[model samples]
Target: MHKIPSSEITPEHLFLSRRQLMGSAGALSVAALLAACGVRTPGAPATDTVPADARTDELGDPLNSFEEITTYNNYYEFTTDKQGVARLATGFQTSPWEVQVGGLVGNPRTFALEDLLAFEQEERIYRLRCVEAWSMVIPWVGFPLRRLLDVVEPRAGAQYVRFETVFRPEEMPGQRDRYYPWPYVEGLRLDEAMHDLTLLATGLYGRELTPQNGAPVRLVVPWKYGFKSIKSIVKIDLVDTMPTSLWMALAPNEYGFYANVNPAVAHPRWSQATERRIGERGRRETLMFNGYADEVASLYAGMDLRVNY
Candidate 1:
């Protein structure tokens, strides 16, 4: 019921740094022009189409069109090509989906799709920065992961959380070709899993998640690169030791266990100093912890980020 406050909303006259409005047009007119052109500051959207009741916070950048965000994505289970993954994911069924929680927990259980949705939902307009240097602003509908984890309380020794994606080569074409590996896996520290910001997303753009975008359920950790938020999750296991992520197993040098968004720590293949926002024209300076430093900074105090990354 409470709305999450965001950064001060920049006036329309100030939103466009790349292009200056000519003449003595009033600031309100500049705002209208930008609205007509579908432009906003950077990470937030100018016009948030999501219903006011559904939203807990408004992003500063304009929301990417649903078509652009959903159709253009990286779901390796379907296909490697961004344009092709959406079509390939259509064959998968999600209505009766179940998520099994186990390992080092006091009460392990399997929850049906509707069961997860029974909890209250909130809309969070988050900046999804990809490891590949592209990003998008998405309005995700879900509840804090801590709510679900509480149902299956972690034991004292549980220090990490491992996630597994559904493995179905028959339905997912990429799995058949042995792209990266079948049944994509990812993990996070127990603290990270319980973070208030972490979400178990069920829908986006005010609707159920499409198969291509990890239908049924998925993890959304805004501070880390997009890959840390695994898709189409089927299992969550609390473990004493850190779990191996699909990207870490595939290329540990390029991807790290923490995977926090840091402009200072560059991926082996590319620099992390900047990111290209999808549908936007240019790159923006990458922020520390993807602009969530105030919220999650204390989680990693003495540890060197450059090495952990």
Candidate 2:
């Protein structure tokens, strides 16, 4: 996801230029903001609050808040329709859930979802962007993906890791009898899988995850397109080479492996050069890491991003 390059993103580039465009250059569109499932309104009292953890930002404020953690999600398995997941996920069986780890790892093990909850769950308020173009500021609850991998211990041959959701047509009606692939598959490079930015969240808010939000357990790849962050994860495998992801398999060039939040590289069908933010706050200019670049960009130093992308 190498962006078009800063020189190409100046004020004159009309496609997504900062010029006097049809809409305000630095704010969210009213309609676009409304369509987002996670957008929140200001003055909204905390109906569901997670007390702030001790881990605070430079300002000494808690890193995450309950309202920001659970209220926002983009899980599509429960339903393609935005409001559907949050509603349907209530019936999800979280207590019986288990995460399966296998493939190119040394400590391949199957642990109950409860086992994952034993760690120190901290909050990280991250700027999340959906491939569809809408975005949000969410505080997530979970530990680094490497923490999970460390226990299972990926083997040397684990060049790529693949994730899949549990496919129960009875519960997950999206398992089309045809038309769509059942048990969607998503993958990540060894490096990306182990990145500190990746999270394996067992719960959001102070409660368990909602079905629509990959309830039992889910992968949170904040920088990659939402699809790369699969929901209701059931199987995790390590492969010797590149693994094809659902979006990539469906349309390769549209989603490159290095799906970094780059503003320069435009999607063939859409313009990611800019994004529409939601919540009563309105839209704002999208930053390099959704504003986390200064913290995560060094991971891609010498590589030819355009090619890997």
Candidate number achieving the greatest TM-score relative to the actual structure:
1
User: How far out, in Å, is residue 190 in model 2?
Assistant: 1.2
* TM-scores for candidates 1 onward, in order: 0.81, 0.76
Lowest lDDT 10-residue stretch of candidate 2: 56-65
Residues 1-309 of candidate 1 have per-residue lDDT tens digits of 966564566666676752455343567688898785566334333232443333322445677767667778898888879878877887588878999999999999999998899989998888899988988888888999999999999999999999999998888878887657668999999999999999999999888888888998999999999999999899999999999898999988878899999999888878999998887666899989988888899999999998999
Clashing pairs in model 1, backbone N/Cα/C closer than 3 A: 43-61, 44-60, 44-61, 44-62, 45-61, 45-62, 45-63, 46-62
In candidate 1, clashing pairs total: 8
lDDT of 2 at 198: 89
Error of 1 at 81 (Å): 0.7
lDDT string for model 2 (141-234, tens) is 7888888888888777778888888887777666754455667888888888888888987666546666666777788888766677788888
Runs of candidate 1 exceeding 4 Å displacement: 1-59
- Scored by lDDT, model 2 comes in at 0.70
Clashing pairs in 2: 3-264, 3-265, 4-264, 4-265, 28-283, 40-279, 50-66, 89-211, 105-155
